[model samples]
Target chain A: MKPILECKGLGKSFGQKKAINNINLELERGKIIGLLGPNGSGKTTLLKLANNLLTPTAGEIRIAGFNPGPDTKQIVSYLPEKTYLNEWMRVKEIVEFFADFYRDFDPDKALTMLSQLGVDAKDRLKTLSKGTKEKVQLCLVMTREAKLYLLDEPIGGVDPAARDYILETIISNYHEDATVVISTHLIADIEQVLDYVIFLKDGQIALTSAVDKIREQEGKSVDSLFREVFKC
Target chain B: MGWDFETDRPIYIQIMEKIQLLILAGVYPVGAKLPSVRDLAQQAAVNPNTMQRALAQLEEEGLVITQRTSGRFVTENEEKIIQARRRLARDQVTQLLVKMRELGLGKEQILEIINEIAEEMKI
Candidate 1:
């Protein structure tokens, strides 16, 4: 299958400091990719490059054979690490806003997800707990029919139970033929669904391969390898 | 269904697989009781959620049977254990054979070594 996202010598810098350096990646369709890295290792920056949130300092990145821009954003559904939703918007209104902006957004899917989480659309976003808000954000992202989904820290916070739900929701809802790049530190949790992994360290690609092949060959889980290589 | 953390595999899978292995080994015995998920999870130092995933998977695969509130018990059908073992062994041998061929060991040489090793088997 053709790569859904391609990066060749991709480098990003902020001022004099490097964010991501000389990275090459090929994201295949219908694959769940885990982006593993220590804090400040540039996993988020690389995702941003794909989303066109930040322009690369050098080299190239292509999503679905197109450079990242408004056209690419249409195909890339992003869930930022921080809350991207406005606090004052009612749950129902926010869904409409997303539906209006993104042609691929499915209002019915969004409603189904919210219903599964027991979130009432009439409630204001500010009244919901932080965890609930996160789920709401997840519901929105999962509602899209994009060709690529860039999720940053989808399970960074919240309790362990919620983590399972978050992971399951992503897994069950994501459309096939689309690439899902989940940048997270929770390796053991999401590694089961991961077709590939990109381990970043000090702004560089440390390791990248099929998660199953690594497990089959090295007899090591992705988490253990992460601990050994990127251990503090 | 306790997990071994040392292996690269996830703890939840370890628990599921170990229980499956015990069933295959006849250690649990057919139709006998299995450890509670809570106890097994505690022994394995894993979260109950993880344990739940393992149990759910086992149940889905028909390797285990659960009763509501009465706790999970081993299934009477012993063929599942044998089937699991056969599948696992088949995979291992296929992998080993492929690797041996890559190392220039022909089938006869590999079988001779296997026979030699089998001669010293405790069983």
Candidate 2:
């Protein structure tokens, strides 16, 4: 089967700044992949390129065989770095909005997850804590049975306990044929769930390898390796 | 409960060791059905794919057997379990010997220390 997400000579620029440059990657199905980098390393830029939020300056990116467009959006579930929900909207209202917007969105699953996370369906987004808001957003994004999940810093800003819950949610909710790409600087917390990792350095592909291969070959965790590679 | 993993080794190997220990400790009794891969992965907070890989390795080692229609189960053969237990004990001994040798201890010294510990523990 073809890769769920593929990029060939993919480049993106914001005027004089080259946020992403010449990235080539292919992610397979049924795997959780980590897209890792430091701040300004183009992790978000690459995700935006794939999500169709920003058009690449050069090259191309494909999600499930189609370019980033309406067709690909149908199969791609994205969780942006910041919460984008309306502050006045209740948790359930956001779920309803997502259900109406995305054909694949499962409202039942979203409501169940919201309750599990202790975010009441009737609570307004403004009333929820930062971490709870993130959980609610994650619940909405994950309920979609999309082919590819682009989670940008999904665990960031959450407490340790909530982080574990989020990770467990990601693991248990994974579809055998779907692929998840989680971009974050918190490698140690997420590495165990990741099958592969792609390291981006200054918008360039520094390295990409199986997480186990790194441990077996280098006798070190991906977190340590990242520290060494991106040491200030 | 979340599974602990050492940083210097492959996670699947650690997961395999964990399951093997569970089997030997009778936590997962002989011939008992194992949890589904997704459930196991969620319990361990690891990826299902990684959990699947570990289970597959266990199956290859004869510690776990998979049925066509049913899910995975611990081996029913007591002999196989015995061999696995012995293998694990041997590995522990080999590691201890290596560490002792690195500390400039001779084989006799290591054996003497083991005897002292065994007597102290009344074993």
Candidate 3:
């Protein structure tokens, strides 16, 4: 089968700064992948190109064999680092908005998750605490039955409890045929859940390996490997 | 609940140990059916592929049996379970011995210490 996401010689630049350079990667189905890097290492840039938020300056990228346009967008569910929910709308209204916008969105699943997190459906987005808001956003994103889930720092800015819940939600919601790529610097928390990992370093592909292989061959966790690779 | 994995070792090895603990503890009783790979993955909050690899290791160890028509089942052999328990106890003693040697204690001294403690506890 064709890979769920493939990038061939993909490069992107912003003015004089290059965010991604000559990166080639192929992600297969049913694997949870970690895209790990430091702050300026182009992790988000690569994900943005994959989502078509930014066009590649060179080479090509494809999702399930299609360009990152409408067709690919249909199968790609993205949760950006920032909260994109409208503060004026209530939680149920936001759920309804997603239900109306995305063909694959499941309102019931979103509601169930929201209730589990103790989030009331009538509460305005702005009234909820920051962590709760993140959970709500994650709940919305995960309720969609998309082929590719691109989550940017899903555990960032949340408490450890929320981080555990978010990780559990991710593990439980993935379909057997879908692929999930999580971009985060918190390797220790996410390592056990990842099948494969990609390390981005200064706009380059530093390492691409399976988690178990890293453990067996390097005899160190991915977090330790990341620290060593990016250490000065 | 998510499985707690140690940082230094391969996760599959930890997973194998965890399953062995479960089997020895009678959580998955002898002859009991084990959960499907996907279900176990969800329960442990891990990737299905990772869970499948762990199950493969268990199957290789003969601690688990896979049926063609039905699903996987815990080994029905009581003797194998007892062997597994003894193997785990031996590993624990080996680790204890390594620590004792690090502390500059000889094997005979360690044995004498164990005897003293055993007498005190009357076991």
TM-score of each: 0.69, 0.95, 0.95
Q: B13-55 in candidate 1: lDDT tens per residue? A: 6667777787888787877877875555455544444566788
Put down candidate 1 lDDT per residue, A1-232, tens digits, no spaces.
Answer: 5588999999999999999899888887877788889999998888888888899999999987889998988889998888978899999999999999998899988988788778899999999998889888988988889889899988876667777666666555666588788898888777665668899998998989876567667789888888989766
- lDDT over C-alpha atoms for residue A66 of model 2: 83
Give the DockQ-based CAPRI class for model 3.
Answer: medium
Model 2's alpha-carbon lDDT is 0.92
Local accuracy of candidate 3 as per-residue lDDT tens digits, A2-120:
89999999999889888899999999998899999999999888888988989999999999998998778889999987887899999999999999989999999999998987899
Number of the predicted model whose DockQ against the real structure is largest: 2
Q: What is the DockQ of each candidate?
A: 0.12, 0.85, 0.74
Clashes, model 2: 0
- Show pairs that collide, candidate 3: none
TM-score of 3: 0.95
Q: How does chain B of model 1 score on TM-score?
A: 0.84
Q: A39, model 2: CA deviation in Å?
A: 0.6
Error of 1 at A177 (Å): 0.9
